[model samples]
Target: MLTKFSITRSCALRKFTFLFLLLSGQILKAQSPAADGKSSFTAKLINIEAATTEVFRYNTTLHNGDAKSKVVELKADLPIGWMISFKADGSQVTSVAMDAGKTQDISIEINASATADPSKYKIPVKAVSGSDTLALNLEAVVKGSYGLTLTTPTGRLSEELTAGSHLDIQLVVKNTGTLPLKDIDLSSQLPSNWEASFEPSKISSLEPGKSQELKARLKVPDKTIAGDYAATFTANNPNGNAPAVFRIIVKTSLLSGWIGILVILLSVGLVYYLIRKYGRR
Candidate 1:
């Protein structure tokens, strides 16, 4: 009951089945080598440390177990608001070819934003060559930022001054950051013939969220004009410096006020005398 057409169809079916099995076996063999190759390598994380806004570098070692070199691509899973860079053998690179049965060194640099949170972070890193993948975990401990703020007790940035007199003002220096600030030197910038000084001269250490009261002594020159002047108070630490501007309003002295009153009175008296003489004529 088998015709020529049936015989041809049977042969076609047999050829198609043989071709499909051969292709499938070849794909499985190719993919299996990569999965097996991953077991021949290891990734190690070393020298991972804490950092602030500044950049921090870490090292990664790739140890090859097979008897051949590998061309691997490097990648990282960094947190939001953070950046990372990679280097190999002291040169900037995104990948490297490791030698057979030897190790390669990679440098990783991580940078966080200024407003990033101060806490511990675990970033994931990976190296891949084809389907062979090696994973690593990097631990980063973030150090808090260093900052300080200077202001007056009453929050007023201006004060009145009398010529030839002494003025006393209180200022509050607060640690407005996460780290403890030490050796904060206080200084002032004033106009000519004016003097200013801080009570303690410098701060030993200002803890986080803590404030200290400081007395500022100011003396105005006798020949100063009755006008506005600008004064600057600066707080400097090892990290950086902060500046606060204070407006100074100089007023006339008591003697000057009395002299002006006497001059006005004499002018009024002369005018009254002149009017009386003219009316009599």
Candidate 2:
């Protein structure tokens, strides 16, 4: 009878221990956080290609996995002469507030140097909330930018000339871009019966931030009326073109002015004589 009682007590103790362990495990699991609850930073499009003159944009998301809200700061490592900004909900911001298990959309805007060479650049970005941090890598492929400016050395686009005479005006062509310009042809549009010619009418090549001086010869017909005329000068290439309008004031010659005075005097004398003779008759 004693042995049977001992055996029964041992079985009951084992069952109680097993039940206790099972209940403990269940309680621990209920209190523990979900495995999927973790902070993350991701970008929808991490790479882009554009001209150096354009602004680059990247769309991204920041997620908070903690059970509490937090403020996440945004930052980036950029090249020299570059600019960067972060935007959330169409407003510029340096940081964002995110709720637990929630996500926030972000827009990154970057501006590369106007003189940046054509190449691929890597930009590392980060989002930090207290002890936890997330990172994302981005790329920008810059392309060549072409630009030109046509003007005069003094920035004056006007000149005076005598009728039936030719005038030489100095002009400047500048490469106002990040890349070299080649095969640039110079041309002009003049008034009817007027003529224009350019010295060194074609430029083989022009480096960035460089300027070349040339001369434009303009000729006006002998009978062209004395007035202000419009002329357009153009510098064109396969990549780009620039046009400048110049005001050309045409004036009669000094000799022509003297002849007009003489004619007026003669007409007055003739009129006076005719009036005197006719009145007497």
TM-score of each model, in listed order: 0.54, 0.81
Tens digit of per-residue lDDT, candidate 2, span 1-281 = 57988999999999999999999999987775443578889998999998888999999988888888889999899999999999999999999998777778999999998878889999999998888889999999998789899999999999998999999999999998888999999999999989999999999999988999999999999988899999999999999899999999999999888999999999999999999999787
| The 10-residue segment with the lowest total lDDT in model 1 | 34-43
Computed on alpha carbons, the lDDT of every model, listed in order, comes to 0.82, 0.92
> Residue 194 of model 1: what lDDT?
93
Residue-wise C-alpha lDDT for candidate 1, range 1-281, written one tens digit per residue:
99999999999999999999999999987654422233332335543555465777776677665556778888889888888888877898888786655567777888875556678788888888888888887777777788788999889999998999989989899987778899999999999989998998999999877999999999999989999999999888988888889999999999998988999999999999999889788
TM-score of 2: 0.81
CA lDDT for candidate 1: 0.82
- For each candidate in turn, give its C-alpha RMSD to the true structure in angstroms: 12.6, 9.3
Using lDDT, give the best candidate's number: 2
* Candidate 2 ranges with C-alpha deviation above 4 Å: 1-37
Instruction: Provide the lowest-lDDT 10-residue window in model 2.
Output: 29-38
